[model samples]
Target: MRKLRIGIVGTGYVTDCHYKAFKQNRNAVISGMCHTYNLSHPKYREKQESLKKKCKGFDIKAYNDFNELVSDPSIDAIIISSTNSLHFEHIVAAINNGKHVLADMPVVTDIKQLAAIEKLSEEKGISIFPAHNFVYNEAMKKVKALIEDGRIGQIIHASFLSSHSISNNHLLGWNPNSELSKGEAMFDSGHHLIYQCLYLLGKPVKISSFKSKTILKSMDCEDTMQLSMQFVNGAMAVLMQSWSKDHSKMINGIRILGTYGSIVLTDALYFNDKKIMKMNDYMESFVRLSKAFSDNILKKVPPLSDLNAVHEILEITSNLYKTAEIESLRII
Candidate 1:
């Protein structure tokens, strides 16, 4: 069996998760790394060598130019962990090169870009997967199953709180730079919460949101956001995200209310005040997600969710931003 050769575009913190996930998969290999810019940086060189040493059994090539990596004959697919601003370009290049692509969340900041990628992907017959790791989560899966089994009855209301701690203006390396971050922590981490809502309640028809830079005033975009959405089925959801000085351990959780009862999730899934599933470590979901993506390419089966799933979330979030009267995000 020929293993899927994955060329990662960004050698950043998230790339380590992807590397670990790929290594766990016997059917995949990290064949290459591409630094979209400034490949001569000492950090880039150090990261390249470190990754190669980590994957000692496989031959890993590092490319300074993205085009070279995409055009490489040995590569099978691209896992884009690049900056949020670069997702559109990296995805387009890979699809145009006739390679499968799995990009990190908020695939593109604009809905128009997503439409272009959708059209191009259809024309090229390649899969462009937005790597929303939460849907692949063990606890999330258990919740989904219980809902499907009518254990939760019809979901009436849901709330998701996703938080990240950024003390003394110390957040993501890109958080302080609006050009690279595009929006703020919401634009990045919000994808997971928003997509999870869409996954559970489907698309929303009415949306309203309030956004503020509660903390990290130095950042160009909002550090906190609250979104309210109304689904066609009459279900309502409130999604909140923040990157502020909060306890790291108490940052994220979800609650869903249905006709029968409600379930609360933090480190485990609890149904009607009873624990149901233990949430596995975050890296495991990435492993399952990577394998599913490989199968989507190798077996030519349906992806984690169909292509429209990506577009709908993009459209919803785009609308949310517009409604909030937020400033136009920068695009690099």
Candidate 2:
């Protein structure tokens, strides 16, 4: 069995997660990595050393130029863990180079870019799977199964609340200036809630949202967002996300209201209020999806989370942003 050689295009924190996930998969190998910053820098060096120690068996090379990593003939797949802004370029380059791509959330902020990628992917015959890790979570998957099985009956309404601590220090430490823009909180964190909503109840025909910057006054991007979606199935969803919380533990939870019963999974389904069953940890779902992706690549099976589904999620988020802007202007 030929190991799938993967070249990662970012050496930042989230790249560590991808590296660890790939390492756990026996069929995948981290062939090389690319970063704009010099790996010799103290911070970069520290990260490189840590990654080397963490990924013991993998042969990892750090490159200053992205093209060098993308053009590597040995790399069969690419993970675009670069800043949100660079995802389009990196993913397109990989597809042109005949490599499968796994990009992090919200591939692009604009619909036009997504459309271009969609067209090119079909032409190139390569797969571009957006890493919506939450979909793979065991608790969420069980909830999906229960809903489908009529255990929850008809889902009448749903709500999701996700809050994270985003102090100036936190933003500077994780997402540097170059990596994020004025409205990245919504684009970044909001995408998770939007995708989860879409995953639970297909795409919404209409979406309206309110996005604001409640904390870190200097930052241009929003630190909080409130979104309301009306699905074609007549099921409505309310999603709330914020970077203003000072809480230590952080919060990510969802509730689905149905005619028969209600299901709740907080912190990726690890905590459940119902006594019937326990929710699986979030990491377990990623492992399952990783194995599924590997099997699909080997056997020519369709991916569980295909590009079309991803495109829909992206489009819905884009619409939500537009709606947010309109609402903001009206309020002003």
TM for every model, in the order presented, reads 0.89, 0.85
Provide the overall lDDT of each model, using Cα atoms, as 2-decimal numbers: 0.80, 0.73
lDDT of 2 by residue, 1-332 (tens): 88998888776666776776777899987778766444456676666565556445445776546787788898898888776777788888888999988877766646678889989988998877777777777667777888888887888898888887765554665453424541556667777787777777887887888877777655566778888888777999998888877472444678888888888876444213455556566566567666666766677766656667767866766677787777344454
**Can you tell me which runs of candidate 1 are displaced by over 4 Å?**
38-59, 166-172, 248-251, 326-332
Model 1 clash pairs are none
User: Which window of ten consecutive residues has the lowest lDDT sum in model 2?
Assistant: 173-182
RMSD of each: 4.7, 3.7
Clash totals for all candidate models:
0, 3
Model 1 C-alpha lDDT per residue in residues 1-332, reported as the tens digit of each score: 98988898876667778888898888888888866565666576666666556445345676756888899988989998887888898899899898899888878878789889989999999888878887888788778878888988988999999877764424646656888877776678888888787777778899988898876777888888889988888989999998875664565798999999988888888899999788888888889888888888888767555557778877777677788896546696
Best by lDDT: 1
